[model samples]
Target: MRTFQHKVTINDMGAITIFGLGAFFCLWNRTNSLMVILGCLLIIVTIRAVDRAIHTSYVLTDDSALQIKTGRIGLTKHILLSEVKSVEKRPFAFHLGHYALIEMMNGSVVSVQPDNVDSFLSALKKRIEKKDNEV
Candidate 1:
């Protein structure tokens, strides 16, 4: 099995910095109730980004399954090679940039943006093709 780490994009860094700074400024001058609430929100967002950076990963298993693990809620989704219909590069709906989109035979789609997207896609495609040939 191979595990691919999540890519820390410019947007991710920007969000973390912005939220961290905002939280610091808000909490530093906590004279108003609204500022405290906003500070707490900012801290939550910053922590979420950190958690995602630390925990999100893609695992390709020897049994032809791709496991997508997400942080915070610890959600995991597994996709079998035989269930994958196609793979393409497109703008991810939930993210700021492009990612590898894997479409399943049942019409579900999963997006993945690994640290080395090209290598990840090539490896996944090769596995899928090999699985196809075997069937």
Candidate 2:
């Protein structure tokens, strides 16, 4: 199995900024319970997002499947390699980070943000080829 780490991206930074704004708004509008609650929830989500990005990884299993895990909520997802039709890399304009769009045979696409695009793609392609040869 091959595993690759998830990279921190500008979107994550934007999320943090949004959470900060929410907190600021809550403080500005004092005595508003709903605003305060939303701000708190934002903070929790931001924290979990950052933590998940740092701790989570994309795994290519030996059984012709890809395993994605999120550390924040211990969430895991699996995708069969044979079902993957294509992988398109969508990079940021200035190289902040990239997302790979995995197209499935069912005409659904799943996007994954990983730290190193080459590593992720190479490993995925290798596994797909390996699985194809076995069949």
Candidate 3:
């Protein structure tokens, strides 16, 4: 199996900035119990997001499946390599990060964001070719 780390992008930074500001303001005011609770919740959620981002990775398995562990909420998804028709690299509109759009045989597309677009594409293409040859 080949593993790739997830790169920290602008989305992550934005989340931290927004959440931090909210939490800071809420805690600083010390207005009411509800606001304090909400601030605490935001802090917890932000920490969880940071932790997930640090540990997130994409795994291309030997069984012709790609395992995705996204940083957001620790979501995990699997896509069968055999079902993939093609992969195209798409850059973010803001030019912050890169994602690969995988077109499936079922006419569905799944986008995956990886740390290194070229490396991820190379590894995925190699696996797909190997799987194709075995069939």
Candidate 4:
């Protein structure tokens, strides 16, 4: 019956480093300047996307509702507690860094990267269990 909420911050060191190296390479090897510039831009955009993903927060209430808020597009999605068919805690996967995927009854999934995923999963499970017992 606990309201669990978590927010995760994006770490930009990797992106920044890649962009810097790409810039350096672009200047040093002018033969492929366009490719290097494109790589750098791609890295920058990837960083921004990751930042948006990480900045998102998830809120789970005792009523079985899951709410997510992403900073970039100012979009918030709410999934009813009964709508979530399953909650899966996935470890760091390919290109996912480290995040969790919540699957809904409709077969749609939402990804969330919380700072403490283990704790988040534990709390979510506990709440769900409690709710089930109440019914």
Q: Which candidate comes out best when scored by lDDT?
A: 1
The parts of candidate 3 lying over 4 Å away from their true place are 71-73
Q: What TM-score would candidate 3 get against the native?
A: 0.87
Q: What is the TM-score of each candidate against the true structure?
A: 0.83, 0.85, 0.87, 0.59
With a 3 Å backbone cut-off (N, CA, C), the pairs that clash in candidate 3 are none
Regions more than 4 Å wrong, model 1: 91-98
Q: What is the per-residue lDDT of model 2 for residues 27-75, given as tens digits with 9 covering 90 to 100?
A: 6786878877877787787778667767888988878899989775778
Regarding lDDT, does 1 or 2 come out ahead?
A: 1
Tell me the whole-model lDDT of each prediction, alpha carbons only: 0.88, 0.83, 0.86, 0.66
Task: Go through the candidates in order and give the clash count of each.
Answer: 0, 0, 0, 1
lDDT of 4 by residue, 11-128 (tens): 4456555666765666567676687677677666656656554566777765687777665555878877666678887765354455678887788998777667788778777776
The per-residue C-alpha lDDT of model 2 at residue 80 equals: 99
The C-alpha stretches of model 2 lying farther than 4 A from their native spots are: 24-29, 93-96
Q: Sorted by lDDT, highest first, which candidate order results? A: 1, 3, 2, 4
* Candidates 2 and 3, the one with greater TM-score: 3
**Tens digit per residue, CA lDDT, model 1, 17-102:** 99999999999999999999999999998998888877899999999999999875678888888999999877655766677889
Minimum summed lDDT over a 10-residue window in model 1 is located at 89-98
Q: Model 4 off-target regions past 4 Å?
A: 1-54, 94-97
